[model samples]
Target: MADPKGFMTTPREEWPRRPVEERVRDWDEVYVPGALLPIISKQADRCMDCGVPFCHDACPLGNLIPEWNDLVSREDWRAASDRLHATNNFPEFTGRLCPAPCEAGCVLAINQPAVTIKNVECAIADRAWAEGFASPRPPERLSGRTVAVIGSGPTGLAAAQQLTRAGHTVAVYERDDRLGGLMRYGIPEFKMEKRHLERRLGQMRAEGTKFRTSVAVGRDLRAAELRARYDAVVIATGATAWRELSVPGRELDGIHQAMEYLPLSNRVCEGDLAESPMSAAGKHVVIVGGGDTGADCLGTALRERAASVTQLDIYAQPGAERDEDIEPWPTYPKIYRLSAAHEEARDLETAPSADADARLFAASTLRFTGDGSGHVRSLHLVEVDQARLPVPGTGRTLPADLVLLALGFSGPDREDGLIDQLGVATEPRGTISRDAGFATNVPGVFAAGDAARGQSLIVWAIAEGRAVAAAVDHYLTGSSRLPCPISPHDRPMTV
Candidate 1:
């Protein structure tokens, strides 16, 4: 155990972010660099180290939470990182991005604040890199099988790394000019710097994972030809077909999908452009959708110096604290929480009121009003109740020089002809159909991550990648050594 009475003695503390005024001025990571190194041990000690850790059950990747927590508390960073990497391929990505369902299931969270599992995990990963603990682990011998992974997101990266370390010849295909699908463009650099991604990709290259960017599998090369070239194929393409909000004046010029707007900002950071064409600068931006993506839009707009930012959600506002009666211990509760973006938004002078949040819960967009030139100028919305039926007498309009729909994704992209050409089947929900072993209907072709499971977290993507790698390894050699974190149908107690 980390500390016999550590949970009792220590108060939970998370890594502190840089001041809002300072952080909003630049695209650097939100944290004060090296801030956690001093206080992390005590935070790690807060783990109760439960006999039956529900943290494991809540994490789709089944991360070894207690082991790493203990190792961190002991200041055995190398060992802690090793234990972390044993199950996860990229703790850095998950550490920065994942919602940390494990903490929601923490035993201590039944009463007190949850153990700082996410912070500890991030510290370990950052330490591992700083100390040269994270390195290429090339296999000693070849497995004599070649596999192709489509997409360069977390799932494809994880599967490619696993297959490469397992001694299989792995080639990852991405449509973008550079690698790291969403990592390269979908995610903002302020949340996670690109250097972390570059570091891992460097390690993968040293370990013999071949990357082929700007090559569309179904267009640049047909799916059938790809199948013939490789012994097996894993489709790790993400659910990118974003859900739409069909309403009057949806065709306004200033309106765009969140993916469309966020990626451009990322490209500006990538030096592809000096400024984002879709920059929210000087605009009154209204983000529709109350999830993480909406918050992302909110933060990005604030950083871009938007005149104002407002986020709208159709669901009723969540409680500030967990309601155990509604969602018992060990299950992730939908409680109101402030994210870094929300924190930044709170300080904006343009906030609606002295006490009001930038977010408007239980609000539904009725339509948009466009300027004479057909650019959006205002958004019409109304408050709603639990049933989402709008409450009368609550209709309102707000200036919206720009509108971003962060409404989430629908399913995988089938327009590329990959699914059609491969003859793969899809579930009614539009996700690719996979068997118990993560295999698609087509022989020797498997699917994983959001491609098969719909839009989900990075943890699930890594788990899906690992599971699919195992199935591919078995299909190629009748038996395999790769670890399978979960079955195709497995579900974690996460949203």
Candidate 2:
């Protein structure tokens, strides 16, 4: 256990971020350099070492949270890292990206701020890389079986790493020029730099994980051909079918999906262009969503020096803190937690009185108005009640040169013909259907991650990937030792 009275003595402290004004000028991450190391031990020591750690139940990975906290408190960086990597295949990704459901379930959160589980997890993994403890672990002997993993996202990469270490020859195929599906293009560099991804890819290659880029499985090579060449196949194509707004003016030339606009900025960071073709520069941008993607667009638009940026949300703003009456203990609460992007945006907003936040809330977009030439010029919206009915005399208009829809994804893009070729069934909710063993109806074929479970957090994707690999190993060998922690349909107890 960590320090006995650590929770009482030490307060919850997060790693400080770079000043918003300074960070906006560059595409680098928002955190201050070397900020967490000095205080990490004290933060880790805040773990209560509860008799019943609900954090394990909260995390799909079943991460050894308290064990690692103790290890970190003791300054055993290598041991802490080993404990962290035992379940999660990609702590670095989750650390930087995940909402940290484990912290939400922390025993400390019942009465106090939760322990810094995500920060400690990230620190352990980063330390491992710095100390050369994260060297490649190639298999001793080949199992002679081969596996083809479609999609180079977290799930596919995790499964490939596990299967390769378990002695199977593994090959990952990506449709884009580079590996990392959403992580590569969808995520901005200000959140997680590509160097973190590049180093991990280098390690995977050294461990004998063959990568084939710019190859679309169903389009270029037939599904039958992929299955024929491999002993098994794992599909992690991910749900990228972006949801659309069917309101009037949907076809405005300046309006685009979040995926379309987000990736263009990512390409600019890759030196593809000095300026993104879809840039919000000199424009009045209006984002019509309230999720992480919307926040990302807000930050990016501000960096591009948009004349003004406004975000629209249909729901009213949440409370400053969780209300037990609505969302009880151990549950993920709906609270107003300011994200790094939101923090930066609040500093620049120049509104006086805000009925529903100076930006927007409880507002429904009526339609967009474009110029005669077809470029968007303005947006129309109305105030909405609790039931989303438009209120009277609440209509307003805002200038909009470029608009983005971050309304979230619907399902996997099946237009490429991969699902039809494999003959796998899809659920009514639009995700791929899989058995308890993570296998589809077709033998030797399996699915995991967002493709199977719908769009979710990075930790869940890695856990799904690890669990699916175990199932594949068992299917091939009849008996296997790989750990299968959760099945496809297991939803978290907490919201």
Candidate 3:
């Protein structure tokens, strides 16, 4: 238990964000540095530490929330960090990037605002780094078996770290010059600085987990050779084949996928380029899709000084409160959330004719009108009904110099040839097929994360990575001591 009456006495407060005017001018994170520590101890006290904490079920990683909350409330950073890292490999990434379904499942959320579980977790993680609580935990003895993990995203990194700590020789293969997949590129610096990622990579290196960059396993190194070299192979390559828009004039200049646009900005941050070639500076940017990816684009465009930015969502806007009948407690609900980017858009008034946010809910793109020089000039759209069918006479147009499709991804990219070369079974939805144990049909082959689960949250990816590591360890040896968080079929605690 965190505090006897803290839940009732203390109101919920979150990590404060920097002023919009200043943050949008730079690539630094949106949060006010050193602000969370001052308020986090009180927030942790608000945790009731219920008899059956649903936060564990809500989190795919099955983190010991109550234990860490108690530790944090007592200002015990070492114990809190140990408990936090017991299940999760990278709390820093999750604390920054994850949407925090754990808070929704909190017992306090039944009536009052939930304990700031996400903020508390982030504070604990940050304090751990500052207090030197995070250190390399290398294995005591070496195991003869070896493992090859493809992809360096959260999933791959988690699996590699677990197996390496279990005394197995592990090597992670990444195609890009950097280690992190989407985290290094698709995610913007405003949400989470890359230094957090770099720090964890350094720890993993010290723990003896090898990383191979700029090496596409299917092309640069044949899957056959890799399979023969390693005792087992784990395909943790995330779903990266992005969805497309087939609207009229989609091929016009200035039309690009979100991936193509986001990576350029990241490259500029990495010092690989002085400026992003696909920058949104002084342009009217229209982003299709209202998910987190679109919000990311919105923030990046704002930072790059876009003249105007608008986001389109096919689904209608949700209410502020949860519909208890449709979504009961402990289950994640669809609610209107004003993200940092949307707040910036509203406060700065960078959107054209937008209400509070730059989003146009229930609006569907119809076509693109181009100038005589073959560059996009404007976007045509129509309001849609619940069925997503266009409503009569609800057409409109908006200036659009750059059109970005952030419609999300379908499955793992096949162009890498990993799927074909390995001959792994795939589901109808294009995800790699795996058994309950996260094992593929092919012997000694395993699949996890987005590659097997389809595109999903960062928490789910890390959970799958830990579970797959346990399965791989058992296959290599007769038994294992690794903790398996979830099965392949296990899902979130939702109605």
Which candidate tops TM-score? 3
Q: What's the lDDT of the predicted structure labeled candidate 3?
A: 0.93
Decoy 1 TM-score against native: 0.98
Candidate 1: the clashing residue pairs are none
Give residue 142's lDDT in candidate 2 (0 to 100). Answer: 92
Assess the local accuracy of residue 368 in candidate 3 as a C-alpha lDDT between 0 and 100.
Answer: 98
Per-model CA lDDT versus the true structure:
0.91, 0.89, 0.93
Write candidate 1's Cα lDDT for 1-495 as tens digits.
Answer: 868899899888889999999999999999999898899999998887889999999998889999999999999999999999999999999999999999999999989999999999999999999999998999999988999999999999999999999999999999999888877888889999999999999999999999999998888889999999999999999999899999999999999999999999998888999999999999999999999888888888988999989899888878888887888878888888888888888876655731246888889999999988999999999989888898999998989999999999889988888999999999998999999999999999999999899898888999999889999999999999899999988886733
Residue 313, model 2: lDDT of 85
Q: Report residue 475 deviation for candidate 3 (angstroms).
A: 0.6
Among these predictions, the greatest lDDT belongs to 3
Q: Could you tell me every candidate's TM-score relative to the true structure? A: 0.98, 0.98, 0.99
- Those runs of model 1 whose alpha carbons end farther than 4 Å from true positions after fitting are 353-356
Residue-pair clashes per candidate: 0, 0, 0
